[model samples]
Target: MQKVTDYFNKPLNLLPNYFKKIGLGFILASVVFVVSVKISGIHPTAEKKEMMKIISKDVVLLGMMFIAFSKEKDEDELTMLIRMKALASAFVYIVIFKIVSDVFGIIDQELIENKNGYFFQMMIWYFFVYYSAKLLR
Candidate 1:
């Protein structure tokens, strides 16, 4: 188990310098997908809308995951610590956001309907927060 954990923890230079671009591309693709769905002349059936939602969610999540796991140019103890801190911070923020959003949902149904938007926002926040913490550290 320890060996498996260690292996999983290893950051491969596999992503190199292109991780950010690839992640950004995924994010953009997610946005474009939603926009296209909205603008398409065909009235979206319930199943189609659901499918699009899942696809968009997957795209955003994949982008964020790519960014999160990507190897930095300088992979050092300090960078790893910063990454861990950012993850902790993002988790806390997500919890708080969810609670607040839930409270707002009691006041407005629209808030509940837009729950997926919160997920997308959280992914973006995680990506930015990781870099921001690194820079600030």
Candidate 2:
């Protein structure tokens, strides 16, 4: 049990702090592009629109991954613990959300079919929990 705890407590090899800024830039650019397209009302063919959605989702997910794995300005044992806790909390939250939604038929079937949607939700939860924890500390 001690060994298992130690293994779980090991720090991840995160990206450099600068990558966080890069991640933020990616997210911001993706948002700007999406907003501009919506405002311009350039309705492409269905296929093209679907492709655009896929591309935008991929970009956002990539940015989120970069942010999730990036190092903090002052990485330490407490930070590592907080990160672990946040990730676990996010995972549990997503699982419960999925189960509840399925049981209640609250969300669209298409959303449940798309794994990326769940991933996006999880990332959102992770950031929320992480920052909230940091602020409280």
Candidate 3:
């Protein structure tokens, strides 16, 4: 463990095109292959295309997160506090929306079609609250 720590303390250089050099290509190939098989409607395949779709979506999300996390910025205490408040406000909106949906469901189940859209609405609410806080501050 000590040797490992010592090694990590030294500066290290990554090989060029490390993601390409490693097995990411294999992952990409499998994603493509499975999708093609699904499109061709081959028999004896146990809906592996669904799994491939999920994996591909996860890869996209991971790639996006790399870009998001790579950006460097500084936030002051007030800005951090405002962000927390904004998040809390969004959570409150989520709870309220859920309660309203449940009430509507009791009244009529068809009131809320496409329940998955609630996530997108919540995201919009977060930004609304965040900017509202900034303006009020």
Candidate 4:
């Protein structure tokens, strides 16, 4: 038990700065790809739609991977604590949003038919909120 507690209490390991930069690049690439796809107005054949969905998900996942692994500024105990808090807050916010949306019928049913879409969106918002909270401190 002592060993386990000591191991878990060790300092955070932050990724190199380049990871964040690369993540931002991948995010930008995804946005551009999506915009181009929308602008092209190609008819959505089954395979094409599937391809697009996969590509979109892949890019976003790649970006998320990089970002999640990247270092925060002054990556220390305090930052880690803040990150944990931010995640908790983001989760609560999303839960409330979900409840309100469901109660008020504010969201489209088809859009949330698959919970993955909502989860992905919540993750994106989670990072945004975390960064915002970090900046405010």
TM-score of each: 0.70, 0.83, 0.47, 0.72
Note the Cα lDDT for every prediction shown: 0.77, 0.88, 0.60, 0.75
Candidate 3 lDDT by residue in tens digits, 1-113: 99999897743332233333233454466568667876887764347656665666556444432322221144355755676676688789988998899889998988677
How would you encode candidate 1's per-residue C-alpha lDDT over 1-137 as one tens digit per residue?
99999898875444665786798799899999798867876678899888888989898788877777777878787877777777777778878988987899899877768666665676667768777877787
Which pairs of residues have clashing backbones in candidate 3?
A: none
Better of 1 and 2 by TM-score: 2
RMSD of 3: 9.8
Highest TM-score against the true fold, candidate: 2
3 or 4, greater by lDDT: 4
> What TM-score does structure 3 among the candidates reach?
0.47
Error of 2 at 30 (Å): 0.8
RMSD to truth, every model = 3.6, 3.8, 9.8, 3.3
Ordered by TM-score, highest first, the candidates read: 2, 4, 1, 3
Question: Quick one: how many clashes does candidate 1 have?
Answer: 0
TM-score of 1: 0.70
